[model samples]
Target: IPILMGLFAAGGTIYGMAEESLPFYTLLVPVMMAARFDPVVAAATVLLGAGIGTLGSTINPFATVIAANAAGIPFTDGILLRLAILAIGWLICVAYVMRYARKVRADQSQSIVYDQYESNKKHFLGDHDETQTLAFTTTRKVILGIFAAAFAVMIYGVSSLGWWMAEISAVFLGAAIIIGLIARMSEEEITTSFIDGARDLLGVALIIGIARGIVVIMDKGMITDTILNSAEGMVTGLSSFVFINVMYWLEVLLSFLVPSSSGLAVLTMPIMAPLADFANVGRELVVTAYQSASGVVNLVTPTSGVVMGGLAIARVPYVKWIKWVAPLLGILTIMIMVMLSVGVML
Candidate 1:
C-alpha cells in the first residue's frame, strides 16, 4: 500500500495531490486496524510514502518543472539525479514505515498510540466483527472494480488530460453516485451516506481550510517576500558547498511558511537561482536543492494542509507524528544534503 501511495504521488504533479490523499485515510485506517496495526501506521504509510516521493520529484510539473523553468533551465536537466534520489529516498521511507508497522503488528504494545488503541479501533473499525469473514460478494467485487477504475482514470486525467482538482473531484463524485446506484441505495440513503462520510472528515476539512488561511495571511503581509529576500542576502557569496547547503536549509525553513511547492518555486527560484552562478554552481543544482528542501520540509510542516489534514484523518496527534517521523526526517535530510553537495562538485 505504501509503495502504491508512493507511485501515485510520483505522478502527482498537477496539484501535489495533498488533499487528494485524504480519502485514503478513511479507507486504509480500518484495514490497518483490522490487521492489528494502529492508525499511526496507516497515516505514516500514506504520509511518508507520498511525502518522500514528492521530495524526490523527477518529472513533477509543480515542483521540478516550475523550479527549473524559473531557474532558466530545461526541466529534464537533472532528471537522472532526481530519479536516483526518488528511488533511494523511497526505499528509506518504506523501510522505516515497515519497521514500525512490523513492531506494531507483532506487539500492539509497541505502537506509539497504544494508549488510544481501543478508542481508535472503535472509531475507525466501528462495530465490524473482526472474527467474521466477509465473503466476496459480486456486488462488492463490482464496487471494488469501480473504485479501482476511478483512481486509474484520475491518474490518467491528471498526467495526460490536464485535469485539475475539480475534474478529479467530479470523477470521484460520479463514481460514488454510480456505486450507490449499483448498490440499489435509495436517494436519501446515498445522500445520507455522503453526509456521514463528510461529517467524519469535518475536522480534516477545517484544518486544511485554516492552513490555507494562514498562507493567505502570510501572502497579504508580504512576509514570504521578506523571507525570500533575506535568504537571497544570506547565500550571496558563499562557496559552492556552503552555498548549496545553506540554500537547502533556507528552503527547509521557507517551506513551513509557504507550503505550496509551485508558489515557493516561483517566489524563490529567480532570486536564488542566479545566486548559484556567483557561488560557481550550476543552476540545475539550485533547482535540485530547492525542490529537495521543499520536499523534506513538507513531510511534517504543520502549515501544509496535506500534513495537518492527513494526521487529522488518521486520528494521529501532531506531536506524536513528529516524534515518530523525526528520525526518518533526520536520515532524509542527511541524504539530501549529501546529494546536493555532490551535485555541486559535479
Candidate 2:
C-alpha cells in the first residue's frame, strides 16, 4: 500500500515493470539520482542497479545444482560459490568492457578500414548475399533432397558402420551438392563455397576442439601427484590448491572430448570430486573450473550442436564464423580465468 500510494502520488513519473522497462530503467535510474550523485557515479549506479538480473541469468540455479551435486558439493555451496564468482568475474568482465568499450567506439569511428585497403577487399560471389546471386538450380534441389535423405540413412549407417562422424561428412557433402545445384553453381562455385565454409570454421571449430586442453591445464597444476612427485626430489612440493588449477586446466582440455557441458559433468564430476578430496582440495573449486572452462571454449567451438546449427541456419561458412569469433573467444577465456582466480567465486 505504501509503495502503491507513493507511485500513485508520482503519477506519470512512476512506471510499472513491463516489457520495455529494462532500457527505461537503464536510462532513468541515473536521471533520478542526478541530485545526489555526480554524473559518473550516477551512471555507474544505474548500471549496477541492473546487476541482479544479469547475474541471475548467467548463474542459472539448474546448472549450479547439477554441477555442485554431481561434483559432491552441497547445492547451497554451489550458490555461494557462484555468487562469489559472479561478483569477481563480472567485475573483471565489466572492467574489461569499460576498457574495451572505448576501443570499440574507436574502431567503429574508422569503420571503413577494411574497405579502405585495396588488396584485401574481397568480392566473391557467395561472400555476402549468395541468396541473390545463386538461384535454386536443378542440381541444388537434387542435392538438397539427397542431403535430407542422408539424415535418415546416416542414422542407420552409424548403427551399421559404428562411425558417428561419417554422418556429418555425408550431410555436408550432400548439402554442398544441393547448394551447387540450386545456385547453378559451376564446379568452381561448389568448390568455393565448400572452401569458404571450411575457412570460416577455422577458429570457432578449434575453440570447441580445445576445451579439453583447458580443463586438463587446470587439473595438471602444481598440486597434482605429478607435481608432488617432482617435488619429492626437490624441496617442498606445490600447494594443494595448485593441484586444483591443474584439474581445472585438464577439464578444459578434456572438454573437447566431452563436447557437451552437462554430459561432461555427468561423466567427470563424479570422478573429479573424489579425486579432489583425495588430493586434499575443495570440490567446489573443481566444479567452478569445469563449468567455466566448458562454457568459454564452447562458445567458439564449431562442432557444437548450437554452433553447427547456427552456421547451417545462417548459411555462414565455417571459416567465416571462426574469423568472426576467435578473438572474442580469447577474451572470454581470459575473463573466465580472471573470474576463477580473484576469489570472486567459489
lDDT of 1 at 81: 77
Listed in order, each prediction's TM-score against the native is 0.95, 0.42
Q: List candidate 1 stretches off by more than 4 Å.
A: 12-15
**What is the lDDT of every predicted structure here?**
0.85, 0.45
- Report the C-alpha lDDT of model 2 over 273-328, residue by residue, as the tens digit: 66666556667766777766665444345445444433332233556545544564
Candidate that would win on lDDT = 1
Worst 10 residues of 1 by lDDT: 8-17
* True-structure lDDT of candidate 2: 0.45
lDDT of 1 at 226: 89
Clashing pairs in 1: none
Where model 2 places Cα greater than 4 Å from the true spot, the runs are 1-62, 87-239, 311-346
Error of 2 at 221 (Å): 29
